[model samples]
Target: MIRILLADDQRLVRAGIRGILDDEDDLHVVAEAADGRAAVAACRELRPTWC
Candidate 1:
C-alpha cells in the first residue's frame, strides 16, 4: 500500500481529497495536517510515502 499524508489549510479541500483517495485500492491516507509545520511533524511520525 501507498501511505499518504495530506496537508491543507482548508477543511473541505482535505475532505474532498480524502474522499477521492479513499476509493482507491492501493492508496491510504495516514494523516492530515492543517499547516506545513504540522505536516512535517506528522510525516516524521507516520513515515508516509508522500506528504
Candidate 2:
C-alpha cells in the first residue's frame, strides 16, 4: 500500500480526500493535519512516501 499524509484546514475537505484515497486499491491515508504545524509533525511521524 502507498502511504499518504493530507494537510488541510477544512475537515470536510480532508474527509473527502480520505474517502477518495481510501477507495483506491493501492493508496491509503496514513495521517491528517489541520494546520501547517500539525502537518509537519505528522510528516515527521508518518514519513509518508511523498515526504
Candidate 3:
C-alpha cells in the first residue's frame, strides 16, 4: 500500500485530490493539512510514503 499526506490551502483542492486517489485500492490518504506548518507536522506524525 502507498500512504499519502495531502496538504493544500484550498479545501476543495485537497478534497478533489483525495477523491481521485481514493479510487485506487493501493493508495491511501493518511493525513491532511491546510498549511505548510501543519503539513510538516502531519508528515512527521503520519510518516506517509508520499507527501
Looking at candidate 1, the ten consecutive residues that score lowest on lDDT are: 42-51
Q: 34 in model 1: Cα distance from truth in Å?
A: 0.4
Best-fitting candidate, measured by TM-score?
1
Ranking by TM-score: 1, 3, 2
- Tens digits of per-residue lDDT, candidate 2, 5-42, equal 99999999999999989989999788999999999998
RMSD of 2: 0.8
lDDT of 3 by residue, 1-51 (tens): 999999999999999999999999999999889999999999988899987
Give the higher-TM-score candidate: 1 or 3: 1
Pick the winner on TM-score between candidates 1 and 2. 1
Q: Rank the candidates by lDDT, best first.
A: 1, 3, 2
Candidate 1 stretches greater than 4 Å from native: none
Candidate 2: worst 10 consecutive residues by lDDT? 42-51
lDDT of each: 0.96, 0.90, 0.95
Which scores better on TM-score, 2 or 3? Answer: 3
| Residues forming the 10-long window of minimal summed lDDT in candidate 3 | 42-51
